[model samples]
Target: MPDAPTGVSRALREAPPDRVVEAADRAIRSVLGASGTVVFVADYRINGLWPVLDSRQPDAAAHALQGPLQRCFSSQQPVRAAATDGSCQLYLPLSVWGERLGVLMVEMPEEPPESVVRRATDIAGEVALALHAADRETDRYRRARRQERLSMAAELQWELLPGRSVSHGSFQLAGQLEPAYTVGGDHFDWSLDDGRLTVTVLNGDGIGLTAALLTAVTVNAMRNARRSGGGLVEQAELASDTVYYQHRGHRHVATVLLELDCATGRAQAVDAGSPHLLRLRGSTVSRVPLEQQLPLGMFAETRYALQEFDLDPGDRLFVVSDGVWGADPSGRETYGERAMARAMRATRLQPPPEAVGTVMRELQAFHADADLRDDAVVVCLDWQGPDGRAD
Candidate 1:
């Protein structure tokens, strides 16, 4: 029989934050009676996985298990393979909610039964939860996730984000930023309260650290208002006033504030002139038009109007900053005029998480793989009805 779950939980709780992975390995080995185990975490780019090995082990090649590991991570499923010595290698996705952390590989003397596989899956989940919580207390996991050091500006923007993706009963939402290593100005945030989901996309004015600081202030102001029981208008007003006072009409943040009713699929929005909103339903894709208002901080006492719209089941909504829509390489036609719609059509069947990445890749290709001229952000949201069915 497998060891009790509390053994793993207790071990993780007692371990120092930086050493949680080591503690998790020992606890998992005891529970599964496995020969060995290794934890591989996804990098910042989500392009590859890197192993966190013990001091005694020789350095392992980062991409050695990329194919199998990626298959398991993308599918959110367990994969079992036969080893040369007749042992079994089981790869399990380590994810919490919908956010994928990495993969857990266990080598067993023999192929485990279904019951053991199920237990292993649960254990992998526990490990992921521990790592997620440990992120705040230590940089161990964060260091492992990076392929290269991030710029000071990118660091601030990244830390300000809520997460890459989130899943709820009524919808699945995911967002990604481009020029990940040196990103500036562009950022996205969201919060869920009661049955309401509020999402904000900001394209701050300026570049580098200046842009990052501008976005940071606006995001925190909005958060402060929302957390204090304020509604959408109040959130926008507070953020706008905060930015105006600091920049004095010199720098502004283009923003889109959206609030959705999960049960009814009703949405209210405020568009402050930057991110472009597109709607995809069945086989068609079109822009969601909103009255463009002066960007936040452009002037003092600028009032924002709330526009309402309804989302049907099976609808996919995408919000992208100017870096994507306005991408013009060598004075060519802008990406939004044509390329973006085609890209959206191509990703019709993809989930929001994958869709956001695909769209970003398309934007990069449009620039011939050159560094983005501006910071870019892409947010994809799929609304399933209250029944959890997508039409």
Candidate 2:
């Protein structure tokens, strides 16, 4: 047998973002005088920016990100406003491997002599290089952790999954879980019995070990409920109750349940504050809106709602977690539902599994080799012609 696949590797997981910011601050203080300095990362697409760390003027530092900083980062050039005025305000682009990471801004009370200015430029270069190295280190950590967690989570998730992708001939289904790291909160399961296919997909809040734990609890709860021989609605209710009682006040689990009928092609879904599920049919891509509610273990006041839809011959269903929606080319904005719709349309011609892969690949491209901030997951189910053929 082939070895298990790792999710996000440990090497890519780098140190926490907070630590990276702190290191950047220390570098600034050591290189430049103690007047005041700040460091911010530029958006990947070079559109807008945001402050990752700021020592002197925190609020102002963030505000400064929105200005013409993009031009400096894009051109990999430095600006010296009041540079010639004797006062000191220097803006330098943080470039690494010919790509801009962000910028470093320094404002000293007195203009340093010529020697100091030259040294400052050199300092900026070193700082930029450091930041780049840090980012790469973080990526390595993420990849290693992802791979490890993915191997474990995939094993657990697969064992809990319905034996085959397209089972019992009534409906066709296949799902894959991709984490920004070794483990993910996103998952799916399906079982066919007595002509009904029970499909489920969930996105537990956060990622890493915590999300994985909650997911384990959730799937176990479902399994126990399933063995109780309860109907779909009853099983879901019992499972929710079990989760609530089991992890009361834990506030980090979100799940969606769907029951499909082989004969009628009808699907009944119960959504508890997860992302939207899409149904595709050639030109028309239908958006299945899930009623918003608190995640599991949040409130006794929260309730799960069940919605139903009929599947056509060529209809397709797709579900995803935050990682997919968070894929933004500009990095400043999220790739919202609209973008997901367009992506689906663009890849409509591909096979079900290939289409899903296409989305993941595109998202990786948008992030520009950057590790995801959270777990990413996507599952596609198609109900067209020959059920589970490997075509």
Candidate 3:
């Protein structure tokens, strides 16, 4: 049999995009002496894992997230268990950076040695990278993850995201949108360049496709500015101008734009509207107050001011949209008033990737598990500073 890495790489390179999973399965079986291999992809809502390109598993069936699979994915580690036939079943997390893709299951004839386990883990990483690359050319992976069709607005919003999570030496960041399949306007984005990180949270005006289109234009405008070596002020100004010209102040996007110096922990921000920033330092949770400016596109030639702040090495920040803070189901109290602070404290022990999801779930529970009245977004960031000491 060929070496695991070489075999997997060759298989992925040779396979058609839609058949990437099948190619990886064949390579893994040949390299690891496995009887069977199945790649399970986490669904869009992340509530279940569905087997992809596996003949034995029905396409409509999803493995309820629990037991070994859940443990492996959550911990980003591999789990081993005894199979019914006195063989071994190994579950390895398939993730890239901090994005949780799913799990890889390998059924071996006997218990795997530590060496085999390590090799399998590496192979799982390769498969994940392959899947991410293949995603650009095929819809198979996307189809496998969706439980149902997405609304037009949700489809546009989702395609605009960079990714759900990213990890770097100086920081870890993650963001999520609620009412995943139907979310219309709330969005978050980030980019890291030259020891600086730029993050933005946008809550577009209006609803449905109209709101989505507005957000898309604003986000792309900001991206164009940032890519051209523009700072936070430039990004905000360009996006504001683009929106104003398009909507003529008839619509606008409430947003927060922040830039962090990874080495010094110094930060600058532009609070254009509804998105709120909260800081968690040690045990206390407090809002990071900024001079609020008009929402983007509120008027022509609206100038924005830059506000400054400092992030300690151990600090955690949460950026939330109005849909989150203003959520008052059935005329109950809003989530931001008290529940949000408590939720932030509860998730202090988790990393940003997990923390974002936990906070979103708490929001759902706050609404008695009903669909949110409006689109909501949450973004969590942990600054490690230059020395990378923060956990």
Against the hidden reference, what TM-scores do the models get?
0.96, 0.56, 0.96
Q: Which ten residues in a row have the lowest lDDT in candidate 1?
A: 57-66
Please give me the total number of clashing residue pairs in predicted model 1.
0
Query: Model 2, stretches more than 4 Å misplaced?
Result: 1-164, 167-170, 301-303, 385-391
**Mind giving the per-residue lDDT tens digits that candidate 3 earns over 1-391?**
3377878888988999889888988888889999999899998777889888644446467888899888887788999988777899999999887688899999999999999999999899999998988988988888888888999999999999998988888899999998899999999999989889999999999988999999999999999999999999899999999999988999999999999999999999999985999999988999998999999998999899999999999899999999999999979889999999999999888888789888999999999999999999999999987888874
lDDT of 3 at 380: 97
- Model 3 ranges with Cα > 4 A deviation: 54-58
Alpha carbon deviation, residue 365, candidate 2 (Å)? 1.6
Q: State in Å the error of residue 373, model 3.
A: 0.3
TM-score (C-alpha) between model 2 and the true structure: 0.56
Question: Tens-digit lDDT track for model 2 on 48-115?
Answer: 45565333443533333344464455445666556455667667776543334567777766766665
Tell me the lDDT of model 2 at 279.
Answer: 79
Better of 1 and 3 by lDDT: 3
Candidate 1 regions with alpha-carbon error over 4 angstroms:
54-60, 64-66
Taken over the whole model, the C-alpha lDDT of each candidate is: 0.88, 0.59, 0.91
